[model samples]
Target chain A: MIRHPHLRLGALLLTACLLTSAAPLAAHAVGGSDAAFVAATRGPAPGPFLYLGAKHMVTGLDHLLFLLGVIFFLWRARDILIYVTLFSLGHSLTLLLGVGLGIGLNSWLVDAAIGLSVVYKAFDNLSGFPALGLPRPDPKLAVLGFGLVHGAGLATRIIDLGLNPDGMIANLLAFNVGVELGQATALALVLGPLLLWRRHPSFLRFAGAANFAMMTAGFVLIGQNLAGYWLTTGAG
Target chain B: MTEAIQPMSARRMAWLLGGATALAALITLGAVLPAEFNRDPLGIGKATGIAALWAPDEVRIDPAAGQQPAASAQGGPIRTLEIAIPLGPGGDPAGKDQLEYKVRLPRGGAMLYSWQAEGAKVADDFYAEFHGHTLAEHGKMTVAEYRKVSETANSGALTAPFAGIHGWYFLNTSERPVTVHLKVTGFFDPVAPGAPGNEAGLTARVGSF
Candidate 1:
């Protein structure tokens, strides 16, 4: 029911914004049921951990929003792959090193940083960064930096879970593999609609509106996490 | 690659920034602040009546939550209470969740307490906080946290610094149901479970040590 010509392309972005925002409230990594399972199980359970990893990525709202922003404007397969690979590399490095070395961060702070990642990507996608007086940052580098923050967010959660020392390496590797698969699956779903919408003539005209919606969602995420951090730490 | 996006009109760009700020402010004040920190200055939360849709990390607690100080338990024996907490998804506890067992103490009373989760290992981890809250002159409550963590079991002692409602707050971050076995030794009163965070009643369940 897109009446105005400008409404057509804006529809998908609006939907994505509304859908992700609504679901994010419940999008944390661990629930009581899952925690019970992890606590009861001993030794290396690579398979279950893999499933958990995939499940986390699939349902992780912050990461998904950032990924959507990443692939939103990309039309070429090669560029998408290159950017995705960079992200994978950055996150993989941090995920493994952060947990492996016992590098800890406050979960709220990490989450807030991830939200900032979304805002950054959406601003970049909308060409908002260029409008500012500052020189434009390299998109690849920005994505890579944000990917590290996103990975650290998950790493902190895992570290809190208290991983078993036995067969930990194998389990971590399997979990990382699961994350890639889940990211790929989500990417396909998000990219398909974007590709289809872009084929329509209304896409170019309304693209600004769509990206702005993304920016709005991203800002909401940042504000929410920041609020959480402030309330918990009592820091104004 | 997206073509260089034609610059948006100044007014439109301003609208984007302004609109996003407004939306974020609205959601924060209406939903997030009330559900998370229970700070609802705007009254929009009570009028609309919605839980926080963005607070996934809030430390969930009993909905009818209030810290009612127990009467003097100066000569009372140790009290043990078994509590069953059905922790919901996410860190935020719902209204009327968690067994907030409290005891009132005079200036210098002490109590020994131990609690453990009974069941399969919980991954989400159970967070228990031993704290005391004192009502000040004008009914303003001030609190001090003694202990908080997501562990399967915890055992320790608490010494009251002042006359107040001192007790333990438990939140299960796990997915399955876990019963918390709590044993208290020393001077304290037994307050009932789920008494709107205030008042006293009979223990919900009593189990042998």
Candidate 2:
């Protein structure tokens, strides 16, 4: 649909830029001063926890990529809201439950699964499953499932931070609220460019390339996490 | 809008998926594995000098090769040590009564120690300095003082900030002779007995190193 060479090049460049920007934020694991702060914090410190939660969501490129894939083809506002609310519900449930229940899984494995979610979403965007004769599950259910996995990953990181038990529920609720706010902010920013791009004739053509890039990033994430598991745990 | 889009051919889809997979493999094997984990599956990381990105050879002075800072938490068995340091002769100068004792500890290693000086007329008569230091280049050392007090008794714990020697220095300024009693228990390796600065012949007991 994009007949002009310059416009096609511009679209390609935009995708490339998006990906490269995501490279530094490859994993959503907290670290450095933020990790120190989390570990040091005790009791109900809602304000800092809220800020940290928002920061995590904004900087989480993996979450953002999956979100991009989820909304790439969605045209109706109501449909978008429905899918997002489902995802948020799933994410929030596991985030609270996993930490509450003290469920400790291998961090690397959880991250790998999160990576798989990205791959799955990108593949779904490309319509790869039905084409391969695989019975495609409901997209809404799939998004919810992936959201659960994402929350598990978040739980793993938070647990690793060694959060004090006192007033943890209040802090967790604040963090969850912050995460939702960050998601909304990110969605607004992404949707603006996406809406403008969709109005152009080239959007459909560029969509495939974009999903392919997301898939590649997912694969890279999987490899990195698996490598981490192998190196740290001495088990494949 | 979704209804108007055409499904791509499986063959073309396969090519794209395969291409993306190959690119990911290339990046992981060539760049990320080496840069992050120092694993060079394809040897590109080694060839391109990226293996050092994870840990530069010169800076990381690990007793065991290839062991990371995270792995340093796997400390050996906990040990205990108690030693008595006798003061110098009554006519000796202020510096003559000073003595030092130290123990080796890996980064993240921890220890609890308490010391008390006997025969000291007042708290100010005894001086103690608790510190840690690592040997730097050219026979120099980098030291960090944890505490300094002119007290007859002190008790505390230390989680080592780095792999180094950590301990105390005691000085008796009183004319009366003083004998310092020290007790230490932790996951640490006591410095070799009778070594320099270990004139008190400090040795650990209660665990096999």
Candidate 3:
């Protein structure tokens, strides 16, 4: 019989938390702001968008946190692929459609929603839904829905900048590609240690604590968004 | 011996998880702890690698008449003004080394002016005046005179009109260092047009060293 020890699970969880949190500090040192590069490009710059997109994804904290939460419970590679695909599909559609359509929403609200998405995922990981007797929302649908909100957030930022449209479509596509690349890179880094740690006996023991920290972070993010909203609009 | 190692009991697992969680929290707290103690304003932090050279002096805008107006037409009457002199290249305070002059206006206006370093690549933009009074009370101030002189096709001198606030944005693109002087005239003397002039002159020296 395959035996899993609580101590082994704890150790695994500890390693995962350390790796995940440290990834951003590492990526930030390499790529500070891809947005600034996109802004600087005057003409049809060669693959500027792709580079910018990758940089943004790598540096974006909210996106990373959400990804971490999604993969936290999944022990199998297939499950990771399935869930991530759902998230990607959801975000990509909104990123392309929202910006392309010129649909605008208050950024603060969108950010707040993004924060809530993190909270939701963390709670779901804790199996809070079954405990509360709530119907389990399809993870795929949830990912897609949240992706739309994320896209809206990106759209709002771009619209605010009044980006010149000369090569905007191409640039945006490049940026999206960059974002995907960055995401893939992050996944690679996260998954390697994760797969190894899962083999350890302590993975399950400390999983709850990591999820709790994520939930706390989610709350902090929501408060930040709400604070931003109040500062901008003077609304509670 | 190929004896299978037994899995930890559920209680033991819980304790292990709890310990890991506590450790994680401690690590995070350690990382963030210093920031709480060393609180600083945004943009003023060291991350940007830039600092303001000269702190802006308080600006005083006085009306030509001895009496301060209740308000002006635009929105409010003009009050005190504050101007900030950002530092320039070579790590020297832009206006600190030079002989600083404080120009007093007739009504109750005051201007704080500074000079830039020689051969410094800095914005020559000077903020003339910032009104602290209410918008409705201060009457609109118009520009009286503006002129410019140039030694070569690319090099030129510019004189801006006397308005509420004026900025001189001159770029020293020349290979040789260029010395440019800016003289701003006019203060808050919101009397009738025919009334005596309450013009005040504020000058700033700028160049590259």
Winning model by TM-score = 2
Best first by TM-score, ranked: 2, 1, 3
* Cα lDDT for residue A215, candidate 3: 63
Writing each residue's lDDT as its tens digit, candidate 2 over B1-209 gives: 23223556878778978998898788777888777765688998889887767642233332323333543455688788887888873447555688898888887788889999988868878889898777443323556678899998999988777778889988887888899898889898878878644656756554544
Error of 2 at A41 (Å): 1.6
On lDDT, the candidate that comes out on top is 2
TM-score of each: 0.63, 0.64, 0.52
lDDT of 3 by residue, A1-236 (tens): 57657556556566465434531231121122544655566655547667666666766667778888788767667777887888777777777777777776777677778867877776666665554556769776887788777766666666544445777777666656777788898888778866776566555555665666666555545545554464333211
lDDT by residue for model 1 over B65-96, one digit each (tens)?
Answer: 54435654455455555454444433445533
Model 3 regions more than 4 Å off: A1-46, A233-236, B1-108, B111-209
What TM-score would candidate 3 get against the native?
Answer: 0.52
Model 2, residue B101: displacement in angstroms? 30
Q: Each candidate's lDDT (Cα)?
A: 0.68, 0.78, 0.50
Clash count list over all predictions: 23, 0, 53
Question: If chain B of candidate 2 is superposed on the true chain B, what is its TM-score?
Answer: 0.59
Per-residue C-alpha lDDT of model 2 across residues A47-110, encoded as one tens digit per residue: 9888878878888887888898888889888888988898898889889999899885777888
C-alpha positional error of residue B70 in candidate 1 after TM-score superposition, expressed in Å: 19
- Regions more than 4 Å wrong, model 1: A1-27, A233-236, B9-15, B51-209
Model 1 lDDT at residue B175: 60
Model 1 Cα RMSD, 1 decimal: 12.5
